[model samples]
Target: MARDRARLGGRRAAGLFAAGTAVALALATGGSLSQAGAATQSDAAAQTAVQAPKATHSQIQLLAINDFHGNLEPATGSGGKINDIPAGGAAYLATHLKELRAAAKAKGQDSVTVAAGDLIGASPLLSAAFHDEPTVEALSGMGLEAASVGNHEFDEGWHELLRMQTGGCLPDGDGQNNQNSCPDPKHPFEGAKYKYLSANVFFTNTQKTLFAPYTIKTFKDGKKVAFIGMTLENTPNIVTKSGVEGLTFKNEVATANALVPELKKKGVKSIVVLLHEGGFPADPKAYNSCPGISGPIVDINAGLDPEIDAIISGHTHQAYNCSLPDKAGKPRLVTSASSFGRLVTEVRLSIDNATGDVDRTNTLAQNQIVTQDVVQDPKTAKLIAKYKALVAPIEGKVIGHISTPSVVRTNDDSLESPLGNLIADAQLADPSVVSAGKAPVAAFMNPGGIRADLASNAGAVTFGQAFTVQPFNNFLVSMDMTGAQIKALLEQQFSGVNGPEAAKYKVLQVAGITYTWNPAAAAGSKVVAGSIKIGGQPLVDGTSYRIVTNNFLSDGGDGFPAFTTATNKVFGGLDIDAFANYLSAHDPYTPVATDRITLGS
Candidate 1:
């Protein structure tokens, strides 16, 4: 619960001194004391002994980070800064965590480092290039004990995620199964030393959780704190459908509630939830302030059992230290560290040894920036350097040129972004002519697949920059769909069953197509009737047209079912390769206008 990081120094010292004085006076008067006086003194001494303060509490430190997304090197542009202070590199993050752990030890506090989730997926090229093996090694080197699994962890599917946990490289299959082995072919991919927790995800056939639901951490004083970890329950809706095919994600609140009694039975009363879901605060400038925090986490926190002392969260990637009340109306600490290792949320919990419960009045949390002022950890730096050397050849090769230092990922009000338009156009231009028989009429790109914005130096865009923008390695796909399905696909962007992230209002970025929509209309019917067209031709509902998209969308990633319904599927080149080819063909490319999809309120 929300409380100051109070010290018991003065008051505890004073009580001990008074007790000592009382004992000395009784000893001095014992010889001259009568028998009845002596008996009375003995009774009083016994009472004093019973009333003396014992070490009935212990303070624990929880160091946490989330949504790292594997930037082994310091992030670039705005991603690397907090208030203009450069922040976040695997090396810097390691140093900060080590310093925090050391400081806690100096204060006689035991510390454990953990992460909320999204630790690996959606990573930049350095880590993503080697299946994020380097990131795992770096975090493991920094002493991360445990972390919750985030939705992005499923980006490469469950088995690959398992490989990240359990050591070893993906077996050599068709190049699709294994991108690369370890960062260095000389050494094997040693998996994460820390454990990953997932309470809610269950296999449909077995109905068993994918990972341990919770783990009990024992401190030096025998005080135990139970940590329950879970990703957002809507994970299935946002991740690719195939990655989580046999898996069913359960309700977050229910998952934790069910585990409370079990933990209590095991004599553990102090509880913390490492949740992979987070909230957005109204104050955009304050990293530690939680003014008007709202999201799925709000409801989840409110529903949690009072036994849970705090929740370290992620996924929304906003930083905040909040005091939220549980179902019992007791203030509980809620926190999140912004993504890409930029910050770490430090939480202190004072637990009562006598009751094995957390002392709610002494719970404290704050987000500490991983500033670049400190010396980087040598071990982490070496790990980064090793990977850098391995990737340098391809990493620095120039793929194309941008007319301006550019980015295409931001959306003001309409969903289409300059980057999205560019990517979609690239896919449309480089269709599967050999397999699909001819070029597709149009292409759609999912916003989630666009990981980073390309910013060129001296107008040159390297493979590393393009790879960072579209690193998923998804294959472009071509298919045939009726005009009715095309219109349905456009309507799917409005929200409802097809929209997993309804709050974000996901809109498809398109090329070779145009549509107008009324925001005031109902969700499923928002796209204006008969307004959808390709190449300025009126659409007949029964007529078929060639459509192109990435494998992820064609398989219904991000809830686009219309894409999955397309007929005569033909897969093409890697999405990144297609984008690179398009850029190469049109060197010195200028940012395209994002005016394809119009919206009217």
Candidate 2:
């Protein structure tokens, strides 16, 4: 029934535009009266007087934000700055949106706000403890129209997302039910007013889309626009496989292009794609404006059909505002607003009345930073305040104590850090983990997942603090790999050598085994052959060895391709649980660098 209504509406809109095209052309031509010498005064007068009957042009403005990750408050101090400009917080974002909307209104334009996904999940204690209900309410208040389903959205699986989408108010941990649990009590999920587009995600059993493939929105001026949303096709690899067990993500480019003909049949010529994947700036340190750089975005953009007028992307978390040529050499406007509500990408488009197409002649695209100079929206501010108060009792409730400071860093500076060693030790102790098979051997953790540093000051570490360090809830998996695979994995870590972002590719802290290597060795052959071992026993080249690590590396994240071909793979163990259990079993334990690895002497 909705399809029938939309199709009818699209046809009517197309007919209206066709009738008005002549008048629009006349009005456009009349503005150049000063150039009458080039065309005869009579011709100019005729063009000005005979305006097409339905001649009217529509200007549409699209505003996008991505990776909110449920941060309701401003991220101040360190770790949140862009070009020295402080950014983020819903209140600040609201202020920016209001100004952008007013500017569009002043220019007689229609506007819609959308997101590229990851609006929730891995949230702060304020929202996560409350089941992310407050975050949903905040988004509703922000008036988010449409969003692509980011990987984090599935953290709690599809059932939870559906509840967040259609239900009203989430329950607080307190036995008492509170109406204020969600800010907008009247319409808690109202902000999800716009449909969630999932062009590529489909259910395996039914072979059908769980959500709408795309959405066709009609403007007051009889202009119809279509938006298609998709995340990176590799979502299954990043997310818990069980969470999406019954679904499959198709090829992004193939899914988007397949929908184009259907949209065109519905008389929608102005098309926009909201892909949840973004490109990394070629230079790792280059925070802004890296042009013609190559990464995931390069392949995805080049593969996109010319019919796609604009592409709003996120995931890589880098920001870029530039035009990359499509297969046909026609410039495709691609923009990524930095993550955590730091920026908003705005695309201004003009529609052609003749063929219902965007006026590719003049399209403007740019990313505007959401600076702290703007005031926070009072309503959003209050919502954050309410949640903070609700979680206050448990926010600082220390669950355990540490004897010494555990330094946490992501680069080579993290070698044998106390905190990393502690985490690696915990993974090895968990009997449920494959790495723990028969007394276990060693455990490895990616540095990217550890988000905080354990302060050496004599303070208790709370559940909240531990969660912040390991937010993804990744499960600990154990597998058996030949000694050759271990060496290959280490070498893969340095594959980015001589590349712009080489520093990022370096491995950090390791547990259970220590090895020394020469950075001067060949990229693929860097790991010293004899230096590898487990528990002081030399790794047998032909023998299979049990290894413990998270699912991220097991599936080849962070360029660890060697693990993908492991012969014996096991699963269903939560790494966070292992860490928590280990902490519980060994309170007051202090980590020390116990010869896990040694630098080449």
Candidate 3:
């Protein structure tokens, strides 16, 4: 009995309570207890407090995914594959999650499905056509209980994002409207059933979070787990300024640490952080393995409170399962499932039900592939079909034709892609855009903004394909910048402001300009001196020239801070509209020559 009590850990309190009840019953039956009995009872209570169990354990499974980006249909190209097998799509993702949950159930473990974030924004044409209602419905159907709000979640502005969470039709003619609520106008759109936690984001006026900071889930035996979700503090640096105008993002570790005491006060101890920031792995090929993982998550995890048991991360779009040390030098699980529903991270946490704390020594985490081998979930398929039918008419409309299946995002050298060049030219050539922002001398496009290559398999391109290439719906912004600022912008492509990503070379595609750079030069001086020219004239450092770029870059996205310093900014028409108009105006479009950016040494 003593050995059994010792194994019960903190549960000894319950046994003490039962013993007290037995003593009361005996005294009631026999009229009164002896002095010796009272002394024995006191001793027993003392022993119970001293023998509080530290060995009892219960396991809970956290099924996590991140950066879903609303791919209703299966993703294609390299995005869809995990090694040799095709993976990802709402249907396959749902089926895999169901199977994983069932498998956990078979082992008598409690399970919950969660996501780190980027679940809705940057969606495909099918889901984006209806304001991502189908994606929200599909996630709800899959039993997704909670997720963090990603940077893209603020793409359509926080107001529309709030509408996405609250459920309602878009206000007509309010300038905030993009797509309708649902296919059947009578049905209207139902918002997410899951919770969105943002412990970091706060309203500038209210100083309070827009959503719940965290949520606690209690299992059958009173084992509780708290999930704290938030995006990276640098959300404003990546997303548009207007979208995050009235908000401020707090540091990840600071916000998480602040919440720990409050959660402890609420009697919740086991904690998992669903962070929207992630790191790039050393090996791009390892989807479920973390070999030399390094990024913002590394430092954030190192500084986190010891109470934070595990962190499910995303946003870098790389899959990695790693165990890193926390502030106390204890190993903590850090996991991210690559974007587009390609993988699911299965984190099994052993919790002490008696103490409501995680058993750090026994925690295990792994990333599982969401392969196409699984059958599609019927509910998810029907949801996708409904949205597909609604979008088919708009999606199938032929916008224009391509001559040689050109306009690719990457060139032979992989720096200045043909598609990026075409997109930059399109923005530069739009008449309506020119009228809105005045005829710009030059335009540039960020490579990250270009989502897909212009692949014309049948020499005919549709609106769907064009929309796929530039899905952000960013408007062109014409601005004035000094040639010195332009030089600084070019220099940023290689080093300094861009941080580690600079080494990967995020070359900006240009229109109406040519420049040469030395790859072997020191950081910040990689751009060759006096090599920048426009229309065969060398760029004058003191000259103020009109420059055009998408709103994302105009606001200094992707580490290009010089764009934010631009003057006389004027917003033009949407980039997709500009690209479509340019395509129609220039039919049988062949790939542009890749002589724009030159590399010396």
Model 2, range 492-525, lDDT digits (tens) per residue? Answer: 7677532235435547456778887666677776
Q: Candidate 3 on 344-398: residue-level lDDT in tens?
A: 8877787776677887655655677787767889999988888777778777888
Task: Please give the lDDT score for candidate 3.
Answer: 0.78
lDDT of 3 at 334: 78
All models, RMSD in angstroms: 12.4, 10.3, 14.2
Q: Where is model 1 poorest over a 10-residue stretch in terms of lDDT?
A: 5-14
**lDDT values of the candidates?**
0.77, 0.67, 0.78
Q: Report how far residue 389 has shifted in candidate 3, in Å.
A: 0.4
Off by over 4 Å in 1: 1-56, 171-179, 433-436, 497-501
Q: What TM-score would every model get versus the actual structure?
A: 0.87, 0.78, 0.87
Return the candidate ranking by TM-score, descending: 1, 3, 2
Cα displacement (angstroms), candidate 3, residue 483, comes to 2.1
Candidate 1 TM-score to native: 0.87
Worst 10 residues of 2 by lDDT: 1-10
lDDT of 2 at 589: 65
